[model samples]
Target chain A: DAGVTQSPTHLIKTRGQQVTLRCSPKSGHDTVSWYQQALGQGPQFIFQYYEEEERQRGNFPDRFSGHQFPNYSSELNVNALLLGDSALYLCASSSTGGGDEKLFFGSGTQLSVL
Target chain B: LAKTTQPISMDSYEGQEVNITCSHNNIATNDYITWYQQFPSQGPRFIIQGYKTKVTNEVASLFIPADRKSSTLSLPRVSLSDTAVYYCLVAPGNRKLIWGLGTSLAVNP
Candidate 1:
């Protein structure tokens, strides 16, 4: 079975621009979560979506938003982006049937804000 | 502060066992410890998780102490492909939104 997949593998945009990143969850997965990892640091939570609704969000600002389609694919949008927004944007897939669920991740989109 | 503290990085040779430990002194009552592996520019892949005691799976074994305050990830006979960052995360509540710094593991050929 194919694992999770992300688009554009890498992206480049100017400061104050807007960018959209997409993720397709793994097969048989229902929940999707997004994360951001700066250089030499750990991945930070952005938000999680289940049943086409955002269930929880992290400490990121409003400029960061996401949507989960009925098909379980997700999109993360950043508006008026700053240089700091450049990082590895990760997408994780998980199942909800069990109380303690594990996530399967996709090779993230490497966003570079110039 | 997160509930876990692990090493920044570790080194291992091919066919050698690699063990990475994390410390979580203030783990939540309902929290479970999870470990993830990430290659460069890739998302974190879940390795294993356990609440307490020990849990073993096909790929790796997770050893959690009785106190639930710490956990270890043991990889048997690692290879160069195992050179990646390993993250330890704590999910304490109904929602699993907590993610922190993961340990970096470098496996030499």
Candidate 2:
């Protein structure tokens, strides 16, 4: 029973550069969501993916996008990154069938934009 | 999405019980209260959740009033390992969760 897993534990990039982070949801889970957390702050929702389509998005700009594969794995892509984009990118997974919707999260990818 | 308000920080000694309350005045009828705890470099972990009344797990207990406007997370017997930021979220089933600053709990020896 593997829990959610994310790749590229840490990344460094410059302004205007792009970065891609990956996530594999927990077993038996279908929905995947991404969040961004700055130092000493709660996570901010980036978007959610279900059935290979983005279902919900937060206040993030268009520079942030994501993809969900058939296997329920996900990828978060940020283009034209700014210095402010430096933060911890978290991946959370949940099962849509269950009414409770308790999420399981991965350790997250730390992105540093210079 | 209803906004949640919790204490910015709390301090307590080990072997004492700690209770952190969260207020969500605009909570909807279908909304449920969920709590999470996070360490310095790790993702948030689910502690407990409840719709109304009380829900208790091995880690903590969640108490939701009948009005559903506020809830309290009770952690029994504090320990230094329990020091972390606790988040309270309110959302309907299957809806995106909205997060606030969360309450930072510091357990002292």
Candidate 3:
């Protein structure tokens, strides 16, 4: 079975521009979460989507938003991108059954903001 | 949410066993300790997780004491490919989590 996959392994955008990244959840998974990792830092939570609704979000600005499709795929959108928005965006998927289920992450999308 | 603390870096030779410990002094009663391994420019991979006691998997082992305030990730006979950043995080009471800075392991020849 294929694992979590993300699109456009790398992307480049300029300040005030917008970018959209996509993610396909692992087979048999329903929950999708997004994270942002800067150079030399750990991944930080962005938001989580379940049943086509946003569940939780981190401290990210309103410029960051996301949506989960009926098939459990997800899209992360960042508007008015700033220089600091450049980072690796990771998509993770997990099931909610095993209360302690671990998240499976995709290779990540490297976003470069100029 | 429980806050985790791990070392900044560690160094060991190949064929040696490496143990990275994490401290979460305020761990909640229902929190579980989980570890993830990440390589440069790649997303993290789950290593092992535990609530209490020792849980061993094919790749690694997680040791959580009864107090549940700290845990250790032990990699036996580590190889060069094992060089990566290891993160320890607490699956909080609300099921939300925040990853710590993580420990960087450098396996030498």
Question: Highest lDDT: which candidate?
Answer: 2
lDDT of 3 by residue, A62-100 (tens): 999999999999999999999999999999999866658
> Which residue pairs show collisions in model 3?
none
Model 3 CA deviation exceeding 4 Å by range: B93-95
Scoring model 2 with DockQ, what do you get? 0.69
Task: Quote the positional error of residue B9 for candidate 1 in Å.
Answer: 1.6
- What candidate 2 gets wrong by more than 4 Å, as runs, is none
Sliding window of 10 residues with minimal summed lDDT for model 1 chain B: B92-101
- lDDT tens readout by residue for model 1, A29-88: 999989898988887889999999999988999999999999999999999989999999
Q: Write the per-residue lDDT of candidate 2 for residues B1-109, one digit (tens) a residue.
A: 8889999999999999999999999998878889999999999999998999999989998998889999999999999999999999988854567788899999999
Candidate 3 chain A: minimum summed lDDT over ten consecutive residues — where?
Answer: A94-103
Instruction: Evaluate chain B of model 2: give its TM-score.
Output: 0.96
Clashing pairs in 1: none
The sequence of per-residue lDDT tens digits that candidate 3 reaches over residues B17-95 is 9999999999877777889999988889988888999999999999888898889999999999999999998974223
Candidate 1's displacement at residue A54, Å, is 1.4
